[model samples]
Target: MSMRDQAVVVGASGIVGQAVLRAFAETPGWDAVGVSRRLPVNVPLHARHVSVDLTDRDACASVFGAMKDATHLVYAAVNEKPGLVAGWVDRDQMQLNLGMLRNVLEPLQANARGLRHVTLMQGGKAYGIHLDPNLAVPARERWPRHPHDNFYWLQEDYLRERQPHSGWHWTVLRPRLVFGDGLGSNMNPLPAIGVYAALQKARGLPLCYPGGPPRVYQAVDADLIGRACVWAARSIEARNEIFNLANGDEFVWQNVWPVIADAFGMAVGEPQQQHLAETMPPLEAQWAKIVGQHGLQAPPRFREFVGQGFAYADFQLNTGKTGPQPPSLVSTIKIRKAGFTDCMDTEDMLRRWIQRYQELRWLPPRDG
Candidate 1:
């Protein structure tokens, strides 16, 4: 009989959840089950996929209740209202996210008697970055919670309230500007950047810096966060704690523009400050032709492929201001001190993931 422990990852179609799914799938002694309402383009081949609506309590109970072997849970799912960034502060969005967490946990707790650890995903939103762009440099996990209406707090509170009575412990990870492979993810910018570059190349134009004034920021490789989730699941130090995650470095968008341009086989051009959300959709026919010409695997229809990513990319890049903005840096010292000390250069990480998407056939190959 196979004795591998079960690792069930919810929101398995998201960038964050995909990373977690791969980590658990690749690791020894763990069987990975990915749960998502939508199927991701690149689910790990070793993992099993579960399709169930997390918003429906009965469905989650029916689904999770039968999984008596689930030993670890990674909750990376979130529901955001339409128009992307504007939904960050929406109260209904907050409640929907909270309820989804409740739906999964209540049944999982009742059925998965042997569940040992749970990992929850949060982001810079916990520090008021979504509401106020001028968050202080190097946000720390030690700081008192910011005054806000974030669903992160709601879900965290739910975990806190239940852990004292439950057999399993929980960990929360807050990562900055996550980048990885999840098609139609609400926020990964890879698809947006890839499509933008391809369209520009198709038009014989340079890859313009299509963003606003320069702003410094940090990013975490989704896979790195995934490994950390595995680390937290096994480490006693991670129990009932929160940690901030990053790529251990920082970069400005325009500063890295040349790297991005070269990746797409294009030269850097003038900063165009184009609103990707406003501009990219109208070029779907152009994208369709590029898809067939390059044998790209992404859906030809832009919305099916990108979801809110164009709008998300616009919000991330086109800040529409003339002055310097504060960088959303977060300290990873706590996690390192706790013993998971993995690190990578932000520029190298970007190059690697861009190449990965190309290899995955989600983007066109850089022409010779």
Candidate 2:
């Protein structure tokens, strides 16, 4: 990796994608370029930004064509919107991802001079959703793909099929819930939960846990994921492997609930007997209105609003492998071992997310 051996990040405008771009820019040997449907807000001054429709084969081809010198590719682009979750939504998030992969890989296979590796960000849903009670707690990469997880399975299949035949190294990173600078993110459960909890507290509403009783919930900073991506792209050990990345520590809902409540200044209250669907009907309605008002594009139906209030409920991750050792107990561990030692204070991260939500008018300021 050298200044001349640039790295191209697709979906550079997204939460994970942007973090990946930032990581590439900070790494010593590589220049970073971001390709997306639109130019990302506040792109780093050093990285190049190219706007292109990833769904269009020609457009994707052209973007990669212009990056002829790129030695690494990080596929981070994703269409964000929760409404596409239904089985028949036809948005095809998986297909779109596959198209981008082919568009980049095909050209690289043909013309790249020093193309060495590619890292694609994926999720835990590939293992299965709504895990059975008998299944082990803290799912591992070795777990077979859940038969029902079409999105993850499709993208993963594409990666597995292409890696050996294309002659380039590949790594798939499955990171459970990621939280970081809250400004432009849509998938993170933290920002929404922080905002919802803050608003509920401000309004004197009870704190609600939407999913199954408190299990373990894990998260990693987006930047950490980015660093891991860069490390994987540069290290031969990372090639053709799958890693589960998350905060090294796992906390039961009992633990995380208090942290969020304290950070948002919410009253320490017990879960309401009311189901989330009932208590938060208004919130759901409001979210729909907000989506319509902002004209934000929708994601695959499978992803639509599925994790809303339940972000902290049933989601648990085993971060011992992907996060830090001695276990920061709050941040990702595997990534730490992968050479990313930075950690974002969990409380601080929560507070900042709350503040950003208020600043963006997504949530209102507390009136003492």
Candidate 3:
């Protein structure tokens, strides 16, 4: 009820959640609780970590029973059943994602007496980006929710309905293609691109633009999203509103592909329209060999090493099916007007995170 001092980040291991944890560490007087199924190895020391399966209602209640001091909740967790993008419309995806949020929100709403704000994460799909590429360009937060079986709608509707009764205010942030540093983050595109480039260079192949057609694109840096979440919680103007979050810049694969290639010290191949899911599977053994040869961080399995981020990145980069449709973009004017003015250069954000992967040995060092 008093100005927020304690924040509970429900999906601490996720790209957005991890950024929230790190951001909270730098903000004075804010203690945080990080909730997730598994604790991330790199979580900030100032925050407390709780490993409670959010899908289990009793488990969630038990965890929050002791969190009465929590004044804010950031729900960044998502439940995407198998097949990634295909699961977007699956009934199970909707049920499971809605249920995960319910398990956490119900218990906290009942128990956390000081809770004042909630931040929920959504993505470009709300504008029908996954359903059809041509529906709209430069998606605005004011657009009607695209007709689809999306959990974003379900969760957002739930939040809006509860606002009058519940003491906490809420904000929904829709980001496109979040790029960040982390293993096991479902939507992180950096490690996937980092690994793909390293492997392709090893085989004496140029780093190719794997997706189809030149299309304009935008992305949100995980750190910026984290900051936005924090700002939304504290900014009175951000309450009960939806904001499209991005780096405030646009890019095309045809132009940035060569830059990515040069970062790995590989030649830039012609844009041939390849799918990484098809091409990267067979190279697992080769990745293992590279790990051994370079003494890189050897993950137990390649998939876990990069998480579903590999397939998700491929799904994101492929402009092939989009036809002559104009590029997908999201306007951030709403958030800027609300007074959160953070921005990042899209290309620099991607390249910087890839460099971080190399420094951490999560991906092999780029070739000289």
Candidate 4:
């Protein structure tokens, strides 16, 4: 019905979803529509957003049914459980995720007759990281599916079963600790770390490392992942393939403390382990005071702005761990060989995204 490629980015408000929506909208000859339960507050490229609860099949039909021009789909929507990690193995959680994807896909497949490609988001958990911390370093796309109960398996299986009949090809991306432009996401570390830095600065304290042991970890910028989605959509080499992605760099939390501390205009304080899930959420009053003091536009409620981010931070940051953790690495050689050769410097990424939050007035500016 439309002249250009219509990219419907499901979960458009999420970190990766937003990035994908922005990339497609900004690219030549593409129109991107954001579909999510709630419209994103800050849409890149000023793209249009539609509110659709993916869990509601009838609702999905009502909305996606009207999007007959949709030519590409980026299925980044996810239903993470409370507490974040435990739900990875929960049976109901797996089925619910599969159902959500089915709801989105069935309606689209029925209406969007021209749909040519689909992208699904997966992460390190696919390698059994939640069940066993010592997963093989630099996990690859060609390896056997790790023996684990994950919602990723459910959704991938569904896609594989349905794709042969649907006239669409799909690509699955497994990224390491995805980071960038998300608010209150169940797994994003940006808001949690930003608030932590802000609260520390407000109290006249240096930035303290609240995480436990120092483990080398890798992260993929949401923007890179977004661009990758765009590339995957058009690249024949990416059809029906899976790729592991990252920034092609690694960092230790303790080592990066200085960069974050300097950004907050604070000195490095003594390292301490406080379960952010336990300590950070209970400080809503304190966060509100900081918000008022800085005149930040952040949501007054901690949960509204941070979601389960603090808990996810503890998990990703290795908070309370007594020793070094085996690095959770994944290979991007496949994606690069497939023609999407994109990378970002992790430290520069940290600097820029932190600055982006400040520029949005959602977090305090750097100290002078």
Highest lDDT among the candidates is held by which one? 1
Candidate 1 error regions (>4 Å):
none
Candidate with the larger TM-score of 2 and 4 = 4
What is the C-alpha local distance difference test score of each model? 0.89, 0.60, 0.81, 0.86
Q: Stretches of candidate 4 above 4 Å error?
A: none
Candidate 1, residue 274: how far the Cα is off, in Å? 1.3
User: At residue 341, what lDDT does model 1 achieve?
Assistant: 93
Q: Per-residue lDDT for 349 in model 2?
A: 57
TM-score each candidate. 0.97, 0.74, 0.95, 0.98
Scored against the true structure, residue 60 in model 2 reaches a CA lDDT of: 64
- Candidate 4's residue-wise lDDT over 1-368, tens digit each? 67888889999888889888999988888898999986776776647999988888899888988889989999999888887878778899888999999888888888886999999999888888777888887788889999878889899999899999788899999888887877777878999998888888887888889988878888889899989999999999999999989998888888888988777678999987799889887788998988888788889787778888998999988877786678777778899999988999888888888889898778988862
Over 50-73, each residue of candidate 2 has an lDDT whose tens digit, in order, gives: 888877888766667656677888
Quality of model 2 by C-alpha lDDT: 0.60
Question: Which portions of model 2 show Cα errors greater than 4 Å?
Answer: 80-93, 130-134, 165-167, 182-186, 201-212, 273-349, 355-368
Rate residue 358 of model 4 by lDDT: 90
Q: After superposition, how far is residue 213 of candidate 4 from its true place, in Å?
A: 1.1
Against the correct fold, how does model 3 do in TM-score? 0.95
Regarding lDDT, does 1 or 2 come out ahead?
1
